[model samples]
Target: MTIIKNPVIPGMAPDPSIICVDERYYIATSTFHWTPGIQLFESKDLANWQLVGYALNNEEVNLRGTNTPAGIWAPHLSYDPQTKRFWLAYSHMVNMAGREFNADSYAIWATDIRGPWSEPIYFTSIGFDPALFHDEDGRHYLTILEWETREGYQAPGHIVLAEIDLPSGKLLSPWHRVTQGFTTRGCAEAPQIYKHQGAYFLLLASGGTGYAHGVEVGRAETIFGPYEAHPSGEPILTSSPRHLFSLGDPDAGHFEMVNPHSVMQKAGHGSLVHTHTDEWFMAHLMARPLEGQLLNPLGREASIQRMHWTEDNWLEMEDGSNLAKMTFKGLAGVPIDNEPNTDLFDSFQEPQYLLEFMTPYRQQHQSWVSTQKRQGFLRIYGGNSLFSQMNPAIMATRATSFTYEVETLLEFQPNHYSQTAGLGLYYDSNNWLYAHVTYSEEKRCPYLTLLQAKLGQRIEYVNTRVIVPEGNIQLKIGYDHGIANVYYRLEEQETWQILLQDLSVAYLSDEGVNGMPGEIGGFTGLFTFIGAVDAHQHQSYADFAYYKVTNHSPAS
Candidate 1:
């Protein structure tokens, strides 16, 4: 049997919705606050994944002012064999102020996986994390959480189901209240359904999204009502089964619940499928924190685990335990290559950027970022600063590893203090650490500076300033676990000089930078990218020769 690693898709690929169409496997994951929403990954053996495309690339919804952990929530993907169409259900979480979540859930269909998907058909605003299930008898059902806001009620919410008409986006029947949870581990959401044998199975994400996060299952003879909990009365799958502190707790970052022994945390929000060989597998969200740290700067990632049904018809891990494992015996005898989760390099030589690269809030503008401006360099015309959710000339890639280094060679001629360009780690507009080159009025020349944003507060490190010559400059950032160190050099062969060291930027993590208490810290993980700011009429341009990221051993 081949051994499949825990996290098949790393770096902020959370809330995975997996479907096996014919012999191919596809997963649609949540892209909170990132534009070109609903990232899709394709796999042949479920071991190696490729970013095929996204379901939402066009402007169906505006995300300009979307708050942290708010924009796009759980996205579900399914296929209706009767209609010969692919259906996608997702929520545009507009606001979560005061815990009254305001979300617009929608469904869209396309004949093929890579759309030309239809315009979003508004489904309901009842709650978020919507999923569509097509029964064998040509019936379409919707499952979602009925977010509870009552003072002494069930804390977070309950799983609810209803019959939905796809074409008109109308509900055919009243909602049926499903189980509050299969176990006492409350805070359930992201409900998905499946059928096996003669019973309908309801699967949910429970125990919150923290360390106690897990997947629980219940089965019913009918679509709704009278669903019986699993005989175990515990999560069918989890990373931390021994922790009992998360029961009935809706608060995020119960960092104390973190499982210190495992590299994977927050292992929940799962979707299941059967392979061609009749083997069972589930795709869920998992996080890989740096060693000895509970903060997950990479965010919740997509992980696959092998599963099986007992003789009594209840689902359990293939290894017969609820606790998640780092390595599982892969589909037996299925040979597959190990996929690397570490590094990348972009020389800006391509005519266009890859779909894996994404911008925040707004669509990419050619006037601001273009390859044609310079022959081999990516020319970025600075617009607004990184704090603006609107138009900022920043192109970013997912940071898959905690201990990695990202460096870029840039030639930026900033005419004003507002026109700066460089590279750094970004969680959102309100949270980031950027080391850049800007015009220093005091130095009377170009100088390198470091800027940081923690929970919407921006701080310019005046002591970190160093004047540099006006030519090609190489800037490097080292993220050794939680700490971020910034370095710069005149040339590739020159020794890197410290611009800033041990910045204690781990607070940029999902557990550390929550704008408000009690809610999730942040869903979108840390991203490494090159960005620029030009408040002065957007005239200045920075040409980046190349960008490189490499995984390295963390320093103590």
Candidate 2:
């Protein structure tokens, strides 16, 4: 039990899959297109996991035109002892641009966990969150959420089971709709199948990934069920202490919460692991909104809780209570200590930029920032408006652990008609907080001003012109609730000016603002966007001496 306060793994680190092989342990999480697709963490001890390497990189797993929140889905990781190879199954959500969410499922194999993985073996058109089970009878099965999109159907889909032929990547058994989730609420997803004592168990995640979200279970004598829901008739774990969050999508209400707590939010969707030391733990998603209000940005982070099973085959928390905690330390595989939580503070002292920076649709060219090009600074060639809900000249980091802070210093001159570059906070291309320097030839001058992406609309001229003086400058942003206040300095000797641009409504947090379903609106987290906009013919490149981001608050 690693009692990790709040998010153990942050940003879109949901639906965690943990596996123990020998004395080593591994954790794999879903990455929604911050290239270098699946993030894998290694640990000798459950409490301190180290980022060993990625499961898939852009070169290995291409997501060239993948849309925001649409590039990848919950990835399930498993090891086949017979094959002695690790298998990763994931959905490359290619159609998110059209908001279709119809993704292409893929399977990749590797002899070593840190791998030069085999070319992706195109798998069936099965729905997302595909899990593979290797049974004792030498049979392999694939279980998925068979998406039910017919009219009258609601959010939180259904579950399906099929026998998959590993060699050919085909579904040997006909897909069976196991649950419409009508009885379990709309959330019939992330299903994992296991066998113990001649009985098969199906572990599921439902309740829409919100406060009502939960980890559920059912059992069947056969792989394909005429299965029965747990006699308890409700989720095994949930966080909405208040009972306000519905367990299933609006319809399955018979087991609705008697009480709910608002403290933990968007908590559900899970996978389990029996550690090398024989301790059982479950990895699921959870969130903490800004100051316990709306604006949950640490989207579906990875959290672990301990669980126990009895000879009768019923599951419960080790302590007989279903409540999860902020942190818990369990038995160690090998004692592992960790370094203080830190992200890269990139100074171009190295030849290349750290892979942590990601662009909207395309990978920003290396020529765009290099050792030879602009001295020590990384220069973003100003290209497009930061307002488009699509690709913008933005590079951001995944918002991990709610309490961390981010700040950057930038220096640039805007010349082109629509060229604007600056430092600000961004959740996605469509929603962000920016203060840029743009030029207007009609006025025959350039100025540094504040801009923002609010309610899907780019609002400008809030304070039309605070003309930027011609010289090296610095821009800074401090964020708490996805909301931020802007500050700037003209020279090293000057004090920071509080640019009065309050980003209260920029992230689309309220009703009818910055998000699309579970994809956008729920909680995309906060990020620093250092972008260049090209509103005209000439390309504008903005030189940033060095961009520094710190979780340290200036007030501290």
Candidate 3:
């Protein structure tokens, strides 16, 4: 048998929705405030996966001014065998003031996974985490969480179901309120429906998306009714099985329920699939914290687990334990060469950018960033500063490993200090660590400086400034766990000089950054980026010769 390791897809891939069509498996994940909204991955053997494409590649949804952890929420992917098409449903969260949680949900369809997708169909504003289920009899239904806003009404409201028309974007029937939650873990969301042996099964993500997170199940004879909970009266899958009761809590960051015994945390929000080989597997979201710290810099990742049906028709882990495992067994006949390819080197020789690169808060268009502008070089015209929620000229990739290095060759001549350009590590608009090249009037030359933003507070490393003659400079960042080191070298120099050493950047994480009050901070993971800033005028730009990233170790 093949041994499948955990986290088949790593780095900020959360809320995974898995589906199999024609024996080929596909997984869609959440992107939050990042553009090219939903991430999609494809796998052939269910052991090795590759980044295929994204659902929102154009200006389908606007994320400008979207707050931290509030842009594009969970994206649900399902295939309709009747129509021979793929359907994607997602939420565009606009505001979270006073915990009102205003959002607009939409669904789009395409004939192929890499699509010329149809325009979005407005579904509901009542809640988030919307999923679509197509019955065998040619009827479609939408399942979503009805957000609760009153003083006290069972916390996060109910899981409601409604029949919908795919062609006209209309609801055919009134919403039927399903069960509030299957277990006492509360905060039930991400409702998905499955049919097995003439019984409809309802699966839920419970106990929020935090430490107490888990996957619970229920079943009923009909589509919507008084569903019966699993006989276990607990989550069928979770990282922390030593449970505590949290019935009415609305908080998504349950810091108290962290499982110290397991290396994985927040293992929940799962989606199931039956393989072509008659095997069962589930794709779920999980997180890995920094060593000896509660802060999670890598955000939630994707992991797979082997599952089986019990004699009594209830779902259970293949090992007969509810706890999530770091390693599991794969299909017997499937052979996988599990060597990870996490390194990237982009020379900008091609006409198009790499598919792994993603931008935040704004769509990537030729007006701001392009490779055709300067052949063999990436020319990025600066837009706004890193603090702005609007447009920022940043092309970043997820940090997949804890021990990695990112390097770039930048050629920029800034007339003002506001037009700086270089490489750095970014989390969001409010949290980052930048090592950039800026002009200084007193020195009359370009210099390298380190800047950091922690919890909205800016810290400048004035003592580490080193003046260098301008032309082309090579910048590099070495990151190990929570510490970072910056280095630079001139075009003619044969050796590298350290600019900043042993700088603690542990605060650039989900738990360290401050977001909506009484809620989890940021949901997106850390990113290594090559960016530019033109706060003075949108005229100055930077030309990058090449960008490279090397991973020394895996996240496990």
Candidate 4:
């Protein structure tokens, strides 16, 4: 028995799609509005995960200026042993603002996991959250969530299974809508099909994507027809411990949750996979707020839970409760240890961008970024302040927690007054902390200023002329939960000085002190950055000396 804690892969690691191939496990997750998208993580142990690479690095997958909850949606990974092929299914949830739920789904297949993955073969244009199942006899069938948009309907959602000739990527038969006003919660979607003991089981994420979120199950003698909901008739897994009015309704995917207890809201929509030794694990979403009091900036992070099966085939939490925690063991009982983990710190010894780096839209201009020059320095050319969700020069990584220190070395000599670069914490465009040195040409003097932007307001608390005889310096940011402080030093200064004080992260949080609406929810974490901004630049670049995360304080 091993005890892994809650949130196996912390901070906005949402829409987890896990697959086991030849003893190697791979997990793919959604990266909404953050470019260099679709991070892939690998693990030998089910409880520990490490980033392997990203699925989309082209500028086509926009992250800059992209809104919350709108980039990539649910991703599914499957392995077809016969062909030794890894097929990936995903959706680009474009234009979520008007609630234009119309999604563009696509499928990509790879022969080598390290991929030169085939260009996506567009799947159905009408839905999202798609999965594929390859049966024992070389038969391929597709399962996806078909939108139920008729207004007067009980729930505008249902799960459908269609047999498809994937080689041509077309449905072979009329899709079967296996769910309607029935057992389990109304928003029945994210369905996975599996066979055992001569029977097939259909697993679904019910209620909408919020408070009523739950994992539901059904079984049928056949893959397409006459399926019966699990006898329990309620969620097999849910977080309604105290049950509040907010946990009401229970939407289509979790549509039932009109209101819910704050304990664990938006807890469903997932895919389950069995370890080689037959242990069960599930990948689902959760959210954590910037302000302890409100779970805003609603980003969906992926959390894994353990499962045990009864002789009669009911799936349950290993200990019979869905309490969110970090540790769980594989059924085979391999040796386990709880080592403290870290996000990603780059010393740049490899002469390439670390896996932790991401751009706004993966803007294919390789000339824009590099790691080959200085062993630990990352060079990025500034281009745009922020563009549409489609593009921006900004680079960002996952926000691993509510509090953590992000420090980096920056060495840049600007050619013009417009080239100002440094490091700080960012929520979105409307709100962020900017701590950097701007060239003051009118005075031929450099100045260090702590500029804070709260939604509609921009406040500069510390604006002082700096004596930077040299061009290189170090920048550090300390976030005590949500309140923030900025620190920096000139070449002559021996120690870091606190440049700013008493800042509120809520301005950058879901509460929306800024122009943006706060995040909706799903336990996603925040992302930090160490880069340059060319808001108004004339061919100038910032060389990131190196960025590292340490237990040591940023101020020191």
Candidate 5:
């Protein structure tokens, strides 16, 4: 047997929904508040995964002014062998004010995974985390959380099921309220249905998406009926196995349930797959906190665990323990040789930016950002400031490791202070650190400065300004654990000068930032970006020669 390490897909890939078509396996993950949403990955050997493409490449959904952790949520991918088409269902979380959690769910289909997808068919605005289950008998069902806003109801809501027409996207039957949760850890959502041995299994993500997160199970003889909880009366998969009863808790951030013994936390929201070789494995979301801190700068990642069905038809971890492991056994005779593709170097030589690059709030288009404008450089026309959720001209990649360095050669000349372009460590519109070049009126020269936004408060490193000669400059950020060091060097200078050192960016994390009263601040992880801001007149633009990311840590 091969030893497969966890986190096959790292950094910001959460709420994984896995499906196996033929012998190939695909996993779809949520890309909240990020454009080109619903990231999909492909894997053949179950241990190695590759980014194929995104389901939402066009402006099928509007995310303008989207709040933190509120945009695309829990994208579920499914394949209908009968129709030979791929189906994707996701929710567009529009509002969280007053904890109403209003969202609209929709589904799209495509003959191919990467291609011209059909127009989205609106399903319902009742709740979020919508999933589609294509039954073996040609019937289809939609499972989603019926978000409860009543004062005296089950906290988040119940996992409801309804028959859905695939072509017309209409609900044929009224929703059936299934069990709230099979385990004591409540806050259940992300319901996925599977069939095995004449039974319909409902897999749920329970205890929220935090330290108390886990994957609970329930089975019913019919498609929608009274379901029986798992025999264990606990989550079959979780990072923390110790029991804690949180039935009525609506708060998703169960910080008190942190298990010190576990290296991986927030192991829930799983999607199971039965391979062609008759082996079973699950793709789920997990988080690795920074060393001893509860802060996860890398955010929720995708991890695979070995699983098996008992003689009684109940699913359990292959190791017989409910706790998720960092390393598990792979399929027999399958070799695990692929490593994580965390390191990236894009010189913008091609007509298009690398597919790994993603933007926030706005979709990537030739109007604002393109590589064809210049032969060897990516020219990005400045849009709005990072503070605005509407439009920000940023091209970023996920920070896959705690100890990594991002470097970019930027050629930008700013006439106004509002027209600045450089490298940054960004979490969202409200939390980020930028090292850019702008006009220095007093010195009468273009200089480099550091700006930070911590929980909506802007802080400028006024004393750490360095005057640089015009033209191309190399900007780099060396991130060690949770701290970041900014450096810059002129085109002619062989050595780099430090602009800011020992700046603790731990605040740019899910738990560090402030969000809605009872919810986690941010869901998307940290990203290193090459962006330009033109809040003045939107006439300024920046040219980036290359963007490079190097990971120092070993691939997980």
Candidate 6:
């Protein structure tokens, strides 16, 4: 049997919700503060996954100014075999200030997974991480995390259930409080219900979304009565197995739970699915930090592991251990030649673009970005500055590996300094490192320069400068762990000249930097983007001939 690797989908893909239809599998993941809403992937074999499409592509909701880790929360995907439709339930978090979490939940349906999905139907703003479960009795139920703000009570919240009308998006029954958590791994959320063998099972993400993160299970005979915790008082699966001394801590930077021995940390928030051969596997979120660093620049990613049921009907890993593994035995008779990887090479020659590319906050406006305008090149018309959430002319792909190189061929003409277009290592508008070709007042011509943004403050490095001739120039950025090196050369110049080297980019991560007091650095990971900024006038455009990303890790 082949050894399937962990993290079937990598780079900022978190809170995975998986579903299988006709032996084909699809996984939907959260896209917080990013455009095109929920990211969807398809896989025939559980090992190999591909970006197929997104569910919320239209203006069903406005994500402008959505804060870090706060736009689209956990998205739950479920299928109704009777109606032959797919239903998705998700939370649109508006604010998280002073730990007073305020969010709105909604659900949408689609006949096909690659949807013409229906406009969102309002659900409830009671809490976050809303999930939909269609029962065998033709009754639909919605389970969510009931947020509690009372003093001296259980910190984050409790799992609650209620019957709801799928058509009207109305609650048919009152809220029923379920178990706080199967164990003391508090910060319980992402509650989902499944039935098997005349018993209902509730699966939840506990221990927050940090190094102590894990998946817990509880079961009850009925839909919403008394539910009992699993016999074991610990999580069923996790990368960090050590006890969390700060169990009740609400800090997102729970650096105390970091496990140095494991390659993948922050493994939890899982969803389960069964294969055609009756084998069980779960897709969960996991993170890979820089070699010795606790900061995960890639954010929590999607991973899967094989499992089996105990004789008493409890679930455990196939190896009978709660600890997550990096590799598992592949399914029998399913020999998928492709492995899990997202090394991109976009030539911009096709009519459509790859789903791996994404923009921030707003829907991608065709007037600003298109490949049809120029046959072999992607033309990006500059609009607002990179800091603007509305319409920044930036097209980026996730940075999957710590040791990867991103390169692009750009042809841009800038008459003013406000109009700059080049490559950037972006983590929101507040934190980023850019090396671009813009007009230099001192040089009185086009020149290459390096700029940095820390907490929304832009700083230009004076030492790095190179005069360039008019035409196409190749720009490359190499990231070795936390250190990033920027290089550029004209088309005629064979040797690359270093613009900046050994610049520390570690701060642009989920831990190294932070947003508000209660918020973490940002759940959104680092992105390698070709961005254009036109603050003076929206008349500038940049043409990129090609964009390529390569992972340096041996496994990649």
User: Relative to the true structure, how large is the alpha-carbon lDDT of every model?
Assistant: 0.84, 0.65, 0.88, 0.65, 0.89, 0.84
Against the true structure, what is each candidate's TM-score? Answer: 0.95, 0.86, 0.98, 0.88, 0.98, 0.97
Tens-digit lDDT track of model 1 for 14-96: 99999888888999998888878889898877777888888888888788878888998999999999888988999999988
Clashing pairs in 6: none
Q: Name the regions of candidate 4 deviating beyond 4 angstroms.
A: 58-65, 181-184, 241-265, 289-292, 296-298, 322-326, 337-340, 373-375, 386-391, 415-417, 456-469, 507-524, 551-556
Whole-model lDDT, model 6: 0.84
Q: Which ten contiguous residues of candidate 6 have the minimum total lDDT?
A: 244-253
Per-residue CA lDDT of model 6 for 307-410, tens digit only, reads 88889988888998888888888777889887566789999999787678888877787788899989999998887777776777788988888789999999
Going through the candidates in order, what is the number of backbone clashes in each? 0, 25, 0, 60, 0, 0
Which is superior by lDDT, 3 or 6? 3
RMSD to the true structure for each prediction, in A, is: 2.3, 4.0, 1.3, 3.9, 1.3, 1.7
Task: List ranges where model 1 is wrong by over 4 Å.
Answer: 243-248, 442-444, 491-493, 515-520, 553-556
Please report, as a residue range, the 10-residue window in candidate 3 with the lowest summed lDDT: 511-520
- Across 1-556, the per-residue lDDT of candidate 5 in tens digits comes to 8777888888889988888887788989999999898998888777778888998988998888998889999999998999999999999999998889999999999988775788999999999999999999899999999999999988878889999998798999999998744657888899999999999999999998998999999998998967889988999999988887888888788888888998899999999998888889989999988888888888999999999999999999998999999988877776667655679999989986788999999989888898888899999999898898999999999988888999999888788888889999999998999998888877777888889999999998888888866757899999998999999989778998888899999878888777655457887899999999998888888999999999998657
Candidate 4 residue lDDT tens string, 1-556? 6655556676667768888776667889877656656778887776667887767765444444455556677778888989889888888877654444777888888886667677778879767888888988898888887765566553445678988887678988988987643344565667888777778878787666655666777888888956787665666666543232222232322233423344345666667778887778877765554433544443556677888777887666778765443445554756545453754677666766667776544453556677765566777776554322443445566666555678877776665555667776666554566676667676575556656566536666544445454667788887766677777877777998877666667545434532233224222345576655565643667778678655332110
Off by over 4 Å in 3: 515-519
- After superposition of all CA atoms, the RMSD between model 1 and the true structure is 2.3
Candidate 2, lDDT over the whole model: 0.65
Greater-TM-score candidate between 4 and 5 = 5
Which lDDT tens digits does candidate 2 get at residues 391-484?
4667766655443445555666666657777877665666677777777666666677877666567677555566665735677766555556
